[model samples]
Target: MTNPMRFNARIFDESFLDQCDERISAFYLMWKAKCKEGRIPARSDFDPLDMVKFLPGITLVDVERDTLELTYRLVGTNEVAVRGNDPTGKKVKDTFLANNWEDVWGNYSHVIKNKGVAFDDSDMPNSNGVMVGDETIFVPLSQDGEFVNMVMLYSIQRKAAG
Candidate 1:
C-alpha cells in the first residue's frame, strides 16, 4: 500500500474561496461567528482523529500574545498520533530546532498584518531532518479585524512508502 499524505492544499486557493459552495461557506461563517463570540478555545474543538479522517493533511495553529503553537495529527497505515507544541511560548525565540520559525513567523506576521490569508508551497523538514514537500495555508482570525489573534494553518506532505 502507498502511504501518501493528502493535505488541504486547495483550501488556500483564492478561487477556491470564491467558489466555496454553500456547505464550506457556511462552515467558515460559523467559525467566524464563533470567533466573534470569543467562543473558540486556544485548543481545537475538533477531534484530532477527525482531522486524520476527513482532512488528513490539515494542521491547526494558535497565535497567542507572542507565540505560535501547533496542533497536529500524524496519520499512518498502522498508527496515529496527535501532538501539540508551542514553538515560541516563553521567549521570542523558537523552541523546536526542526522548524524554521524565522520564515514561518515572517509569513504568519504578514498574514496577521494584512488580516488576510496566505499560501505557500515549500519543503518542510520533519523530525528526521529530511525535507518533505508541503503545501501550507494561513488564515488570520481577528475580533475587530485589526489585531490578529489566531491563525489557522493546514498543510500536507507527500512521502514515499517504505
Candidate 2:
C-alpha cells in the first residue's frame, strides 16, 4: 500500500493563479471547480466544444489500466510549440518526452493509482543544453468512479528556450 499522505494536494492557489494570462488561468479555475468531493472529473464530464477559448493549452491523455501506460489522445494547438510536434494517438514512451519518460511516467502513474491530482514545475534541459520550463497540473479522470482511465492537463507556461 502507498503512503496515505502522498495523495493529498495543496489548496488551489487563487492569488498566484491570477498571474497567468486570462484565458489559461480561467480555464484552470473552471476545471478545478468541476472537481467534486475531491474526485477528479471524468472525460465525459467535459465538453471540448464548450471550452473553445481554453482549448489551445489543453491535452487529453488516456490511461491503460492493466499496463499503467499513458497514451496521448489529443494535443492542443499551443502545446505544439512546447512539444515540438503533435503526439496524438501516440504513447508517452514513444515521443520526445522519452528523454525524461521515467519522470513523466512516475508522475502519471501516481495520479492514476491514487485517483488524485499531481502537479510539477520543472525546467527540463535537453542534450543541447536548451531548457524548457513548465508548470503542469494533471487531473485524473475516472469514468467508473474508481479507475483512472484518462487525464486532462493544463500545462501552464511550457515555454521553450527559457
Candidate 3:
C-alpha cells in the first residue's frame, strides 16, 4: 500500500547504476554510452539490435510539454502482460497499473523537468495477479539536447525471497 503522504520514487545520479541489477545496470550503461557531450540521447540514437535483450521489458513514452501529459508510445510485450493490457496510445494519467499513477507520473515528470534520469522500485502486479518486486529506470531523450521529448523506461520483476 502506498502512503498517501510519501512518494516511493527516488531521483539518483546516473553514476548510481552499480546499485541496480546487472541487466538493469547494463540498460543504463548502454544509454550512457549513447550520450554525446553529456546531452541526452535522442530516440534515434539507439539501434534495435543493441537492445534486443531488453526489448520485452522496455517502454517509450511521449512527453507533451504544452500539456505536461505523457502518453505510451510503445509498451513492450512483457510490460503489456504484466499490466494485463496494452497502454500504447493511451495517456499515462489514464493508464491503470498497480503502482500509484500519481507517483509514476511524477517520476516521469521529474525526468522530463530535469532532463535527467530516475530509478524506482516497488511491488507490482504480475500477469498472475500476484505481486512481485519490480525495479525500473527512466531515462530522458531529447532531439534538440535542450528539451526532453521522450522518456524511455525499462523494468524487471523478481519474486520475493522467502
* TM, every model: 0.47, 0.72, 0.88
Clashes of 2: 0
> Which rank order by TM-score, best down to worst?
3, 2, 1
Candidate with top lDDT is 3
For each of the candidates, give the backbone clash count: 0, 0, 0
TM-score of 2: 0.72
List the pairs of residues colliding in candidate 2. Answer: none
Higher-scoring candidate on lDDT, 1 or 2: 2
Local distance difference test, each candidate: 0.45, 0.66, 0.80
Of the candidates shown, which would achieve the greatest TM-score relative to the real structure?
A: 3
Provide the global lDDT of candidate 2 against the true structure: 0.66
Error of 1 at 1 (Å): 30
Model 3 Cα displacement at 53 (Å)?
0.5
Better TM-score candidate (1, 2): 2
Q: Using alpha carbons, what is the TM-score of model 3?
A: 0.88
Each prediction's RMSD over C-alphas, in Å, is 8.1, 7.2, 2.9
Q: Write the per-residue lDDT of candidate 2 for residues 40-73, one digit (tens) a residue.
A: 7778888878888768778888888799777899
Candidate 1 regions exceeding 4 Å error are 1-59, 64-92, 96-100, 144-146, 159-162
Candidate 2 stretches greater than 4 Å from native: 1-26, 96-99, 125-132, 158-162
Best first by lDDT, ranked: 3, 2, 1
